[model samples]
Target chain A: GAGVSQSPSNKVTEKGKDVELRCDPISGHTALYWYRQSLGQGLEFLIYFQGNSAPDKSGLPSDRFSAERTGGSVSTLTIQRTQQEDSAVYLCASSPAGDTEAFFGQGTRLTVV
Target chain B: AQSVTQPDIHITVSEGASLELRCNYSYGATPYLFWYVQSPGQGLQLLLKYFSGDTLVQGIKGFEAEFKRSQSSFNLRKPSVHWSDAAEYFCAVERGATLGRLYFGRGTQLTVWP
Candidate 1:
């Protein structure tokens, strides 16, 4: 409500299991983004949503990674057959407009065991 | 495609010392630049942003960044460093206004020694 919110601050899953990470952007925000940060790495752009439609999904690592947004408010990232390398912090951010500063959430730490 | 480069992977500075973190970007047009800080176990917070204007932008935590179009750089600076300023810093560039795709650098870890 106040800022971007992400669920499951920490997640542990089996190597082949699938997992879903959720992101709730700030109220009235029109743009949302998802990013992945591996240990010792920078933020990797995963996707961007402009009013519940993803205009750019080029950053998604593989076909197994899919994401969707509904009602322009909440988004979910799904990973099928997770791998150990998938372990990282999944961050969500939302901006009032397309080209403005974005507020971020604490992120979901996913650890694929 | 756009990309960001941060030269220093890690840096150490004593408390009260001046600090500068270098960042460079490659984009087709005038890009939207930003600097973000991530403290340990915390989310990333915006330090400053540059879209257009004086080329100099001020941000919270007593930090400032200068955008040099000629050099394709947006370097972040602080007059004096504090121990609490120790964190990981990232530089990013918006590829285009329509796409809203952001390319981020590999980040620089700042360690302030007392």
Candidate 2:
């Protein structure tokens, strides 16, 4: 892909339903990151995957939220039993091996009703 | 714990006026600094970054930022503001020792008045 690609530009679901967000990073990029952006708020880091191992999962908001990356190319972020607070734009970014600047995707706007 | 702070919530400036947005970060050691801009309903785009070099760094869209270690600040500046520059600006920092985790500030909204 020319740049990072995210699926489901917008998602609306019931409060208790689960949702899966996908991200296809730029080819050969070694670092992928997930972030959440609430209304009028800055991005909050969720998880970072370097290769297959996520050395830093400290940013995950809760146990209900989990993410995994396979083949170091695509990543999926799953939110189990979504809540109103989970209604936000889920963003994904990827950077080259050196980790200088990151390229971001359009993001999935999640709405919990 | 590493965090970024952007004190001003909203700022309004006339077009062609000078603009400056402040950012502060807390980290044990010198960290990688970055500035990103987000337009309404758009994804974030990198403006500039500072790892280790001259304190001042230039970025796309005529944006620039300076990393100040003593005051723990990395402020974005534009010589002359434009109406199109109206957007939300964010400050981010990566703890150097740590690999890919980036801490971001609350953000500042810039409003340009014509």
Candidate 1 lDDT over A4-112, as tens digits, reads 9999899999999999999999999989989999976668889989998988888899999999999989999999999999999999989887457888999999999
**What is residue A108's positional error in candidate 1, in angstroms?**
0.7
lDDT for position A13 in model 2:
98
Model 2: residues with Cα > 4 Å off, grouped in runs: none
**What total of clashing residue pairs does each candidate reach?**
0, 0
* Model 2, span B22-104: residue lDDT tens: 99998778899989999988888999989888999999999999888999999999999999999999989888555656788
Interface RMSD, in order shown? 1.8, 1.5
Task: Give the range of the ten consecutive residues with the poorest summed lDDT in model 1 chain B.
Answer: B94-103
Instruction: List candidate 1 segments past 4 Å from native.
Output: B97-99
DockQ of each: 0.66, 0.69
In model 1, residue pairs whose N, Cα or C atoms come closer than 3 Å (at least 3 residues apart or on different chains), thus clashing, are: none
